[model samples]
Target chain A: MTATKPYHHGELRPALVAAANAIIRESGIEKLSMRRLADQVGVSRTAPYHHFKDKNALLCAIAEMGFEEQNQMTREILDDPEDNNNEAVFARWVRAYIRFAHENPETYDLMFGREIWKGGTPTPSLQAISKTSFRLWVDLVAKMQQRGVLPGSHSALRTAQASWAALHGMARLLIDGIYVQREDLEEIAETVVDLLTRTTPDSH
Target chain B: MTATKPYHHGELRPALVAAANAIIRESGIEKLSMRRLADQVGVSRTAPYHHFKDKNALLCAIAEMGFEEQNQMTREILDDPEDNNNEAVFARWVRAYIRFAHENPETYDLMFGREIWKGGTPTPSLQAISKTSFRLWVDLVAKMQQRGVLPGSHSALRTAQASWAALHGMARLLIDGIYVQREDLEEIAETVVDLLTRTTPDSH
Candidate 1:
């Protein structure tokens, strides 16, 4: 994009990100580096430096890409006309989140676990997309409650917040190998959706 | 001990582990290097090699310590005298688990979120502790069903898993900055406990 561009390295930024992800997969986020990534992507060191001022910039970009993917996943589930009920809709969203975490553990980790926003702000672009994903949940839960799918007196707002955690914990742990058995995930995921939606006496 | 002891560091092994954990805390585990860790700890380069075969070994030991700390948290919570009752006991465990996640994000991540049982056999040394935690909820639900407080059907098991997920999810997100207000956490924690336990639909 500038005078720093190499003759053969036109899309060096994307290439670096892809290479970093590959290295994360083989080893983990710990081993990824600008020089190493540049070498693997066959780009000059200065190419990555131009796109990402530092490694955090690269990580932030990866996180933004991940958020886009997450938004797509959420949209796919939430916008699906075939999800005839609240339970079905929520279940689909949870599945999408779990799949996203499983496939893109590094990106997911960067987004969720890191204090990348430590200076009182995360990368604005990524944060906005992440908020969109969360809003999808908040809105969905509210709709479910309005339909009387979620109990009313119990504070649906709290339920929505807790609901995010439940799915996040399950997916994070599952992907991290803390809970390796694919055997029980479906049952657990379905139970989560139902538990969030089911009516209880306190609501009445 | 006999062969590898540097004159300066008689216990280079434990010192290296401590240094590695410090590195993990200050920087993400991805940036850690044996040489860098040694430099930080004021040890010779070869000193780390004698203690840690590699960084992975050091990481696993740190993770193992986390697992052990997790045990202490759960055990203390469960053993609280006021937590003898089913409702109180489960709530205590939830609070402790959440606190552990909040107080030690990196440790919790390493213990539970890092690679899924490194080396593929799923050694899962931590499984017993987690299952014990799981059984605490399962048993409480079983007791509720026995007391006619909830359904006696297989739904109880699903409900238990869901309940665990909900509590776990709340804590995970709270630590991850998904829940910004810390004061809201105590109130929400109590709300989740009361709603799930006290408002059994079966009681109707």
Candidate 2:
């Protein structure tokens, strides 16, 4: 009770989210619960309930944070002036995306795992954020297509889907420990980039 | 106790695996347990203990079944005399693979999910089956490359890995219900086939 009183009301939501993130990172997402998270955050058991309707809602919030972080990282990479070539910029984004998934496996799973998306029950806000992130990829795909960096023979949407599927698949394999060899990530990423942009004018 | 005496010892392994598959299909994998499965099978709880070491071992057995089924499907597709053209056969195989994953979501999840592969603890038999399935794919990739159906510039192993990653990614997306346009699967498969074999002699 004494510990609960010190945290301002405004701090409670972020505090709970931070604690939940820590729990999921240190342990696995299956180990998280509203009651346990409340205890970890030094709040009343029901306090977290006020902020998140249930575990799914809390997971959506955490996934939302990941999308925001990923979107920002992508934007930073795109805006950087150092790598002016389209292939170089795109390759850097692919590597960064994989790196993010590897560094934050639990959070990455939350962002793309079956828990939220399987039933189409993700919180509306979370869905919107995910769509925004995907939209960014689609836009980039369109730009690359226009610049002759990607094959223009296919529609931008289909091209984006195929390319994103490759990246997503590789990331899942690595993050889930199916592929097991961390040293091969770079080589695999390069191979994928080569496969995607092989038909480009610059490549020839 | 009388129920336990009826089943011969030799019949138990396949019986237990079949029950586990039915349980996973009817409900989700999380609802499956040895005791409940034993009850469902009209056997003593200890009966399942003799067949499966634990849930992980049981899951591996179930997954091993999926791989065998998938491998048979791929073989039948390859051996069909009707589609001798390499590109047509390859496209048919890709579509069949995605269709299998979509139709058998629970079984597919077990086959590729983190439950078996995350800790590198897949049963030796399961690993052997998975390797055999992959070897089939790598062999197909090599054949396609030799026939000028896939890019010869990339080594067969790397090409196989990249191509499999794409198919695996698409399968995961569809199976998890993340990408839920059943109508678009054929088109997506066609697009993937085009992407993979765009440089082929017949494609040109």
Candidate 3:
């Protein structure tokens, strides 16, 4: 009898996600579908279903990677001894955040856009990763407060949320092309850093 | 011969835009189509096409209305003599911006989302209204600087972009559901106002 060949693709999960990312980048998330993605990846239509329960699940996985990528970049910025000064560190971090969004508009949209969150479609895994990522930000805010880089009068959670909203807002503006001129990024980032780090009388 | 009934819908343009807004609110912009909208509006399929060249044109029209509504609200807030103090005026404006976005998520998204701007699809009419709206914000920022509400160290344009970015960011967060916890809106708005208006050494 002839030996039967294994039907499994080498790394179907990662392969599907990578293909989805490419599709989303080339077109947009709205164009992505399980059958289309499977076809693009040279797999059976049902094969993707086994890995991701549905399209939302696949999007969540893609967004999960975005969070991980952002978190790693954040860690690298924080750990860099070359820019230990509070202001420089904070500025670099803000720039990095915006740069990430600008470079990966599709992924960034999936990570924070209305598609997942507003639609109430985030998977349990997506929620878990996103919560952890947010906690990391809160912890960093507390550290900045301790170092006098951020105002200490407000709670760390509050400070993190407010400051993050600023950075996130700018990122969205740039990514969405609402801000128009790309040259304004540096000035805008500087202004944001200054506003966020200005020592208040109450904090002093 | 009996007189032919008028085929023209008296207010086809406004009626089509209104139906489009309702459809977008209920099922998102992607689900909105010219054929479906015409059917919902009790008009011939080609009727909407006459008013709007395509779906993008319809979206631009809706977003144009959003800009008009927001600009009117902003004008009222600024013109109101009740809140004369710099901090109060600034805070009220910020809160009003967030409230508008929160109340009209889909409209806000269309006005500022990547769907229109990133696709390079904003109509000339939409562009004109949006430019006017942004210019109004810049003018307000300059006025705030003159009044010592915002730091004079930075250029009015830079400060306006940055401050507006923060408010815009916060609004996007709230509208997208990424911020979760709707109860924190008030506190977050207060924190943002404080950050934006804190006395700078140069200003002092």
For all predictions in the order shown, the interface RMSD in Å is: 3.4, 2.7, 1.6
Candidate 3 per-residue lDDT, tens place, B101-138, comes to 88888999899987788764999999899989988898
The C-alpha stretches of model 1 lying farther than 4 A from their native spots are A1-9, A14-32, A76-87, A115-121, A154-156, A202-204, B1-42, B79-84, B115-161
Label model 1 with its docking quality class: acceptable
| Model 1 lDDT on a 0 to 1 scale | 0.67
Task: Score every model by TM-score.
Answer: 0.78, 0.89, 0.91
> Candidate 2, residues B31-148: lDDT per residue as tens digits?
7888898888878888887877877888998899999999999788766777667667777788888989887888888888766776336999998998889888888888888877
RMSD of each: 5.0, 3.4, 3.2
Alpha-carbon runs more than 4 Å astray in model 2 = A1-10, A44-47, A79-83, A200-204, B1-12, B44-47, B78-83, B200-204
lDDT by residue (A1-204, candidate 3, tens digit) is 536635877799999999999999898877888889999988888899888887788899999999999999878876676765766777777878888998888999999987788764899888888888888888888888888889887899888989999898789778776745788887888888988898876544
lDDT of 2 by residue, A162-201 (tens): 7888888889878765533678767877887877776733
User: Which pairs clash inside model 3?
Assistant: A169-B169
Candidate 1 chain B least-lDDT 10 residues:
B115-124
Better of 1 and 2 by DockQ: 2
lDDT score for candidate 2 against the true structure:
0.81
- Number of clashes in every candidate structure? 4, 0, 1
